[model samples]
Target: MDTEQQSQTKSEFEREPVPKSALLGFKSFIGMYAGEHCAGTELMLGPLFVAAGVSAFDLIIGLLLGNALAVLSWMFMCAPIATRSRLTLYYQLEKICGRKLVILYNLANGVMFCFLAGAMVTVSATALGVWFRFKMPGLNDLYPNSVGWVVAVAVAGGLIAIVAAYGYQTVAKFANIAAPWMVLVFLVFGFVGLRQFIEATGTEIGSLSDVWHLAKTQIWKGGPPQEGQVKFTFWHVTFFAWFCNMAMHIGMSDLSVFRFARKSWYGVASGAGMYVGHFMAWISASILYAYQLHLNPADTDVLPGPLAYRAAGLVGLLCVIIAGWTTANPTIYRAGLAFQALSPKSSRFKVTLITGAIATIAGMFPAIAMKLLGFVALYGLVLMPMGAVIFVDFWLIRKFGMQSYYAELSGKTFNWAAGLAWFVTLAIAWVLVKFAGVQIFFVSLPGWFVAAILYIVLSKFYQKKLRPDAVQ
Candidate 1:
């Protein structure tokens, strides 16, 4: 190929506008979701269910019902909008919410994305520490346990950031490559852990009741949370499963990913992630934890690196490292885009590097990963409001006889309706959590509805006053 042709091909592959042809078949999404969800972090998140004292029915049935709702939301709500607009969430927000509002959204979105990526960095570093025999943190341990852990995290973070800096194509390619192997590893971890559990208990698998009894007595026994941990009930598990990725699904952040899909059905592919990563992988990882508890009941520290290394040896260790990268890469890329929107002139690659650096720094602090449950819930609540605004603006605005993308059309720098809706919804959700004693998991759903209602009301009022002729 000529120089120009080579450059075009490289650009096409790198930023690839995701052709309608490549928008996706169901299989592509299935693979992507399965791989993306069944990652190393599952090792951490799954065990937390055990810590939270979920009963067998609650853990199994709740995840099934909750994850199904999440998938349906993506298909019915998120994907249709994405297919129609074919724009990144950031760009879409710019049109509806305006540049000023988007800048604030991007900051919040970018910072949250960075913290999430940092947790993945922590996951991969755990594997590195295992390989090098570095000291790892315990469950309650918040600070770095050793210098070796720090260096491992730095090296792993640097590598993940570099992959992310290359942009979306690289992140997607890496995910595609690593996802299959990671899924197998998660499967192996589950199977091996189950065998170990069966052997430890000397229980014969004769009937469903036997399994139920074992699960209740042995596995996810409903009990008080560990010290320094909040108690979790069935509602907590149900809502957490539903809104853990509230920003992506309900908040419409995945518009960037789903915009490439040829049809909305591709949103159904998220079911793979929900079931494989969140459901299956979680159960598997919890099995690992149950085994660990059986072996050492007093041990509170749960690290994926050591856990995997013990189960599948070198292969398991590698899975931990690469699995963490696969998950973090796209996250950092998304974060980079958020930051880049702040300064459209700045190079996305450079901004991504800076974002990666921030993530690396955050990764050094184990507390973020250690508190993954609460952190994930909080992040979703914070970002879900803007998603609600986008949803309402795209689908509901026309019905109200108001213009969609009002900011772009009116040439407004800030859309007070979008801004107030987002902030006010979050403030109300915060109040619910603090004063009303509502569980954090359930807050986002109500918060999203509040934001939607607020956006429509505020938009109608603001537009009527500002552009009276524009309102029907």
Candidate 2:
């Protein structure tokens, strides 16, 4: 590609509102959410819950409530403003925060995206390891086991990156096609795994009540957490399910996604992902893990490729690979937009390619992906405060008689109030986790409120002191 083409920022619009012509139908969102949620991460995450020592009731009931909350967060917290403003999260933040502050936030956002995409690459590479009979990362492993594993990840990352570099249109198309098939495969994994458990154990099952009994006794039997895993109670499961994608919905990163919607109600389409991916897929994947435990009783490895391969043979491996690709493509694409925002003059495609390379390198280290439960929570927490900033600036600021987009109106290159609120909320959250003994999952919701209140209050004093005439 020519330098001009390479440097083009095709979709990361920094100034203009998205045109009405680009609005997508609700079904487009359904397909996107379904594909993104019922993905490679589900394979890894399902097993992690099993390690967390959750009972059947906690898992089932918690997920029902959690998934409902997640969908509502999208519909109420993210979608309305996204459709009204029709701007990418980066551009929107740049308007509220100064360009300099937004740049730093974008860097953090991009890095998180790279790491997340890296984890997906790792999940898919496991399938390649199964196919080629090469060494793969094992449970508790921190690094790539062999050269073959690295090669597999690099190959997968390269293809996924190229697809992402093409932009969101292609990514959505790929996901729309993959989501239904992957969901079907995931269901099969659960059913086949359940049958194996029944046959191998000779468990009597004549009715739904019998199945519930088996679930409590054998499948989701609650006990001490596995080594290094925390015990998850009903509340923990509920909160984790709701906030698993906290950064995207409540954190407002999905502003970019929902900006294309024809109406705010299209945000309700997120229910497709929440119910299908987080609820059903999560439960099914957990069942597979439960069956694995039944078989060996000692093997604690959480290898998705091997688990699936054992269940449905090669079809399972293919599901792992496809699921990873579908998730990683859009993630890398978003990461590229963040990077490109740092250098608006640069080519988005080249930026995305670089982001993909970073993800590929991170994928070589298996520790983060294996401990994905905690890592995902941390990543979401990091980006979440900014979402609060956006929310306050958009709706609450004017009501509070504070200037919205003060930085943009003042021609300031940095907004201290927004920046301070962003970091201080995180620091306070960290203190709660470290000193106050609050869990990571529990801190995010309060952290968001802390950020919103801090931003508004600080903006009042800071603006009055710095720009008295500007404050209403």
Candidate 3:
């Protein structure tokens, strides 16, 4: 089972590839990607689109194009490489970039995963907060507001972490149980909110065009930017949708997920997420927020709990809690794997438990969850260059007369070419954001190309220098 944690006795595949006996079916991937994508973060991200003041046409059209691109990237770029190589991103990177470089990568990957898992925990806490009546963070909140908020987060995060520490089987079972019900709740949110909108506005909405008109004028009105938010356009929506999962697909992080697949075509399974979670769930959640704004324009808080409660009542509330757990559980498990990569001799349970603690502490603060829009963009950008490196090493290095895995072949502790590619590409991305007036959402597209080209070019020079007799 792909979801079950591999046996503890299994090593890092230092000897052979993942056996064919271990490969999983397409349905496994469909469930996994859908569960991961249509999860707690969707609750956070869907409302944010409305906050950005996106138009009906732009938001709708952009998501269509962007999600298609994400699905294609998964099928063509991520899956083939993962299935062919049959190595985890960590093991593969260690081979190409060497142990010293991979250590730094693992540390960064671990922290990023923890913070992301923490955000999901925060989402779960909001459901509890609804019952406890604890102070929840508003849109602009940067810190934990009350002791009730703190305790809610700690308790929520602790439980999520404990489940993750038990390994992938526990995480998988939890997600499978929750995924179907949560997805149903998301759909109910859309329909209930839509009915309310028609009733509230007294509009004669009877056809698709009526819904389209409502989408433009009443819901996503293409208005001026909200206070402390950016105005989103077609390009912004398209790019953000595509790049939101940049680390997982374009950056090869899902190499971990897809490595267990029976066939590369299983990559198409991500469509379950792009359409279900990113499309329907996002639009539905937006309807809930739009309705809230209609009722009380002053209540501009992007809290998912209140929004969901208004739509499906109690079922929605319970769904939010379970959705957040299923989402965070796998992420925490992945983070645990990253931490375990750093100390191969350590037990995964201990490292994962400790990683979960870090996430719980992070959940106490509202900044990570409240600022999720920017944080997700930043997370994808930071991790993307390594993915580009993986791509280039897999396909282009040997064609360029450069030896792949030069660091491993030569017994070096670090590969400067890979390091330089990572650093230089990030520098270029930073320059684009800081000086070129490029938004974070659009920066990774060009940044990916930069990392790919730089890795190939640098490998030629860096490797040749290491082997004086080698030709470029």
- lDDT agreement of model 1 with the native: 0.82
For residue 191, give model 3's deviation from the true position in Å: 0.7
lDDT values, one for every candidate: 0.82, 0.85, 0.85
Output the better candidate (1/3) by TM-score. Answer: 3
RMSD of each: 3.8, 3.9, 2.7
The reply for model 1, stretches above 4 Å from the true place, is: 1-23, 166-172, 465-472
Where in model 3 is the C-alpha error above 4 Å?
A: 1-15, 19-22, 166-168, 345-349, 465-472
Count clashing pairs, candidate 3.
Answer: 0
lDDT of 1 by residue, 306-340 (tens): 88887889998888888888888888887887888
Rank ordering of all candidates by lDDT, starting from the highest: 2, 3, 1
Candidate 3: tens digits of C-alpha lDDT, residues 8-54: 21354533467787777888788777766888888888888888888
Model 3 weakest lDDT span, ten residues long: 1-10
